[model samples]
Target: RGSLDLNLETLSGNLIAQNHSFHVLEKISFELPRVELCPEVLKRAKSFVLADPIFGKPGPIDVLIGNSLFPQLLTNERHSLGANMPSALGTIFGYVIAGTAPCLSTAPRASNLAISLLSTTDTDLHSSLQRFWVQEELPVYDKKSEGELACDKLFETSHTRDSQGRYVVRLPFVDNLAYAKLGTSRPIAAHRFESVERRIHARNSSPLKALYIDFMDEYEALGHMKKPPHLNLSAPHYFLPHHGVVKEHSSTTKLRVVFDASSKTSSGLSLNDVLLTGPKLQNNICDILLHFRLKNLVFSCDIRQMYRQIKIHPDDQRFQLILWRGQPSLPLSTYQLTTVTYGMNCSPYLAIKTLQQLAQDEGSNFPQAAHILKHHSYVDDLIAGASTEAEALELQQQLIELLRLGGFELRKWVSNCPKLLQQLPASHQEPPVFLQPSSDPMFSILGIHWSPVTDCFKYNLNFTSDAPTKRKVLSLIARIYDPCGFLS
Candidate 1:
C-alpha cells in the first residue's frame, strides 16, 4: 500500500495490508497495471469503508479508496492508467493529486493534499517525490543558514606539556554555555577503569594483549597519545572524564579499542551527555553509491586512520586521557590523546567537517576529484567513477594528491579499470582468492560484503557453538547490515 510504515505493527514479520496511513512516518509509490471499479461497487465501498479518517482528519480528503474492496471491483475488461490522468481528473473525476488553483496556505486552517496512484502488484516500491511539491509558493519560510553564527564546535585552544614533556591540548571552557553543563572538572570513572584494566591484565588473553599493543603503536605514531608523569597533575589539566572498553569484532580475532565518552568524570556529567551530536554532514550511503555508478570506469579507496588524520584543538587534548602500562610490573601510567579519538561524541562531526573543509578549500585545483570528495565520500571512504580509463586514472591520482595536500593518506585502492589498479602498489590490490575469507568473493564495499569482480553482493553463513535461542537468531539476522535492501 502507499502508506505502509516500516514500523507498522503486525503479527507476522511479513506485512500484508489493504490500507494504512501514518502521519508520524512517510509514504511512497510504484507503477502498476491500472484497474478501476464499477460505479455501483465503488459507491457502496466508499459509503461503507472509505469514509473513515486517515490518521485523524489530516485536512480535507482529495481521494479515497479501500484497497481491500478495490481488488474485488475489477472485471474482465481492463482499464489502463496512463499519462492522461490530468485531463481525466479535470473533466471527469471530482478531486485530483494537483490543483490549478493557488496554494491554500494563504488562508487559516488551509493545507494542500498530495496523493499517488499505487500499484498493488509490486511490493518493492521506489518513487520520486520531485514533482509532487510543485504547488505555487504563497509565502516565504525562513530557514537556518549553513554556517551557524555561534556553533557548539567553535573553541579556543592552548598547548601545554605534562611533566613527561608530552604535549597536552586544553580547550578552554565556553563562556555562554547553558544547555549542557560540561563541568570544568572532569569526573574520573576510577572504579570502572580499574575493573576493566584488571580484567584485561588478569585474563591476559593473547588477542586482548595484541589489540592493546596495536592500539599503543598507532596511538604513539599519530602523536595523539602521550605519557604523563606517574604522579597526579596540577589544576587546569582535565582527565576528560572518560574510560576505555574492548569491543567484540567479527572479522578479526582481536577486539577493537573503544573509549567510553559517557564515563562520568569527577563531575557528575559525561562528555557524551554534554557534547552536541552535530548536523549529519555527509551524503546518504545510497546517494554516494548512485553517484559512483554514473560513469563506466569505477574505483574506490579509503583514507587511512580517517579520524586520526584530523587534529583537534590542542587545548582539548586533556579531555581524552586514559591509563596505560607497558608491563605487568609497571604501574598504570597516565596518557593524554591529542587528536580526535574513536568513541567521542563529536568525532564524526570533526572528521566530516575536516573532509568537507579540505574539499571546499582545494576543490578548484582538482575539480572532478574535488566534486567526488564533496559529494560521494561517506566519512573517510571514497567511491568515484569516470567515463574513460584515462579519466579514471587521472581522478585517482588527483584524489590521492588532493587528500595528501591536507596530510590525508589514501590507500587500499581497488578498481574495475585494469589500468588504474596497475598504477597502485601491489599491497593496495585485493587479496588472492585463497587468502580471502571464503570461497565466495565478498569484499567489503562501504561495509557491505560485495563482489566488485562479479558486480553483486556476497553473503556468508557459518555454524556456532552457542546454543540456539530466539535472541541469538535475531542478533545474527540483525548483523546482516544491508541498508540498500539488496537481499530483497
Candidate 2:
C-alpha cells in the first residue's frame, strides 16, 4: 500500500512506529521562486473563505446576543411581567431590578407607576428611591398622560448602575458629539484635499523616511509636558532643557547638532543599542547645522509629512506600539507607519537617515553644487534646512523620491516669504527673487502662517538670525522671539 493511504490519526502506535522505521526522511529542499505577492489577491482569498455564503449567511445579532457555554440555549423570549405592559417598560424594570443594572434619573421619571408598583413588592423601595433621587424641584410625572415632556425627561440624564441600584448624571453629550462630528468631518475633507495636493506635490515629499527613537524618560524629565494645562493646550511644549544641565551653550557657525547627553536620559540610548555611530552622528550633526544656514533664506520650504516617508525595517517593528480602539495598532518605529503621527524616539534619526541617503543619490549627480539638508526631532518636529536655491531644490527633489521609496505620498509644499517686495517702489532695488517668500500667513514655510493678529509666527521657530555687520549676517538667534517689530 502507498504511504499516502495510511491514516495517521487512526493508525495504531505499533503501525506508526513500523512505518517510521521503514520510512527514510527525504533530504529535499526546493527553492521557492521569489514572486511579489499582491495584497489584493491575499485579501480576496481570506475574505472568500471567511465570508462565504456556503458557510451559512450571518444570522441576526440577537441570535447569539447572550448565549453562554453551559446554558447555550437559555432563551427567555417571553417576560414574566404582565403581557399587557409594554415590552420596553418591562425590559427596563427587569434589567434594573433582576440583572442589577443601574437606573437613570430618567428611569424614575419615566416609570413613576412602575416604581409605585415595585414599592408594593418590596417595602424598602422608598429608601431606594430616596438614595437615587436628589431633593430637587423635579418636574412632576403624570400617570395618566404620556407626552413629549415625559419622553424628554426620561432621556435627560445619562445613567449607570452600581451595586447600590442606579445613578444618573447629566452628560456633555451634545457638545461632545458636535465637537466629534466637527473633528471627524474636518479631517476627512481636509485629507481628501490633501490627497489631491499630495499627488500634485508628490515630487516635493518623496525621498524621506524617518525613525523616531524617543528617549521617553529624558523627554519626560525635560518636562516637555511640564507646563500647566492652559499653556500646553494653546501650544506644544518642547522637551528642551533650559535650567541646570540643559542651559543653552555657545553657538557654532558650522551648525552644532548636539544630542545633550548630560541630562538624565542622556544614557538612555545605551539601553537599545541606539549608539550614536560615527557616521550616523556626523550625518545628524550635518542635518542640524545646515538647517541653521537655511533659516535665513526668504523662500524656505518644508517637506510635508517628511518623517513618515522613511520606513522602518519590518524586523524592527516589535518596539512601536500604540493603542487603537483598545487594541495595539501603531508601531513605535516610523518604519511601519502609514500616517504622520507625532511622538516617536527613532523618527528623527530614521528620517534624517532616509534623507541623507536620498541626498547622496541626488548629490552624486551634482558633485560640485553646494547643497545641504538638515533634520532634527525635538520630539516630533522633523526640521530640514538647505543652503542655496539649487541645493534647496535638490533637497526637495531627493525628499520626494525618498518619500516615495518609503511608501508615503505627499502634496504641494508652499514656501513662506515676505510679500513686501510686491509693494516695493519701481526704483527700489528688489532683493533677488530667489531669496524671498511671502509674509502672508497663507504663504509661510512649514505649512504654518505668521499670525499678524497675534504678532507672532504661527509655529515655533527652531532657528533665527540677526547680524551686527552691514552685510546680511546669517546665524541662528539665541531664542525665538515675537515676529512683531522684527526689523527693529
Candidate 3:
C-alpha cells in the first residue's frame, strides 16, 4: 500500500492486471467506523457472493483497492439485496458489496480503526544515500558487559605466576552466587560415568575403552588432575562428567577427553551457568589471515594442550572435580583438575589473557615475537610469517623462546620453507605425512585447509544431492570456509 509496485491475491485468484499507471499519493490517513449487519439479510438474498470469506469478522485490512484500479475490475452488473442492505456489484475479478449495510446492533459503536500511509519515494536522494551508507558501514564492537568488566578487573588484580613459570588465574564466577547455590553433583556425575563406562564396555569397543583409559592415565601423569587429599562429600564442589572425542586424523593425539562443565546439579545450576565469560581478547580472524598472507614465507603452529598449561587457582580447583576409574570393576575416584579445563565457560578468556600478560611482561626483550603473539595469533593457533628467510628464522626462534618462558610448548609446526622445518626438532614438527611429496598434503589452519607446497588455501566441500531448498543452499555455502574472502 505504501508503494505502487505491488502484487496482490484475492479470494477468486491472483490479481494479474498490469501496466496501468496512476499518480502516487504523497500521504494518506483515514479512520473507518465499524459496521455490523444482520445475518438474515444475506440469507434472504436470491444470490450471494462473498469477496472475503470472513468479511463479517473484525480484522485489519491488508490492502485497499483505490479508485485508480476500480474501473479495470468492474463488469457493469449489480444485484439489489434489499432497501437497507448493500447491493452486490459484479466485477471481472469477483462480486464486491459496494454500499453500506445497516447496523444490526441498536447500541452506539465507536470506530478505533486508523490507517496511515506515506510514499517511500518522498525521501530525498541524499537521505536515502545516508541510510545506505549507514547499513554498509562496519559494526562497532559493543561495550563490554558489567560481568566482563568485572572478570577483567579480577584477572588483572589476582592472576599470578607459579613456581613452574605457568600463569595461574582464579575462575571468573558471577559474584559468590554460584558457590552459594551449588548443590550435590556427585550423583549426576556417577550416573554419567556409569553410562560412559557401559558404552566403553560394549561389544567390539575394546579399542575405544583402552584409548579412554590411556587418555585419563596421561591426564593424571601430567599433573593436570590429581586425587584430593581429604574427602568432603558435603562440601560445595562440582563433578565434571567427561567423555572421549576421537579424531582419527590427528597426528599426535588420536583420542582426547572432553569434560562437561555444563552438566546441571541438584539445584539446577551448572558450573558454566555461574561463570562469567570474559570479553573476547583474540585478534579478528580476518585481520590475522590478512597479516599471514602479506609475508612470502609463512608458518603455523599451536600450543600443545594450551588450556591445561595454565593453572587454575587452588581455591577454584574444587569446582573442577571429576569422577574416573580405569576399569569397571574398580570404584570411581574423585580427582580435582588443577589447571584451567577445556569445557569451562571462562577457559578461553583465561588462556588468552595469560598469553597477553606473558607478552606484556616480556615483550621488551622479544618485540617481534610479542607483536606476532598479539596480532597474528587466533586462540591457540599462531599463523604468522616474515618477508625474508633470515627474518622468518629469527621470528621462529624468538617465538619459541618467549613461549617457553611461560611453559607453553608450540608443536605441529608447518611452513612453506623446508629449511625452516628442518630447524625445528623432529618431535616438535608436524608429522612427515604432511610433507610427503607423492601426495598433496593438506594442513588445517584454524579450520581452513592449507597446502604448504603451493602456499594456497584449499577447500574440501562435500555436497549432498538433496533438493535445493533455502536451508540446503545455505548449508552448502557454509561448507566453503573462505573466511579470507579468497573466492570474492
TM for every model, in the order presented, reads 0.58, 0.25, 0.69
Q: Rate the local accuracy (lDDT) of all candidates.
A: 0.54, 0.28, 0.79
User: What is the lDDT, from 0 to 100, of the residue 433 in candidate 1?
Assistant: 32
Best of the two (1, 2) by TM-score:
1
lDDT (10s digit) by residue, model 1, range 341-418? 788766786677667766766889988888888888988789888888888888988898788877677877766778
Better of 2 and 3 by lDDT: 3
True lDDT of residue 282, candidate 2:
23
lDDT of 2: 0.28
Instruction: Write one digit per residue (lDDT tens) for candidate 3, span 1-488.
Output: 22345554343334655544333443333323255455655464435555533344334344466776778777788888778777888876566665767656862574565655445643344344445455345557889999999999999999999887889899998996668787778876887788788878888888899899998999999999999887576778899999889999888888988899988776657899889999988777777878878889999999999999999888888898999998888987899999989778888999999999999998999999999888889989998998899999999999999999999999999899888899878998876344346668888877677788788887766777777887556545544556666775
What is the TM-score (0 to 1) of candidate 3?
A: 0.69
lDDT of 2 by residue, 1-488 (tens): 01112212111111211222111122212211112223332232232212111111111111111122213222343322222221211221121111112222232222221111111322233333333243222434344333323323323333222342212222111222221221111222222333333332345533210001122233334332121322221221112111111213211111111222111121111111221211122233223324433453333323444543333332222222221110123331111122212343333434444454444445555433213442342222234434455555554555445444434333423333234223223333212211126643432322234332232344344532543542212211222232222323
What's model 3's lDDT at 233? 65
The backbone clash count of each candidate, in order, is 15, 44, 0
RMSD of 1: 20.1
Model 1's number of clashes is: 15
Poorest 10 consecutive residues of model 2 by lDDT?
Answer: 55-64
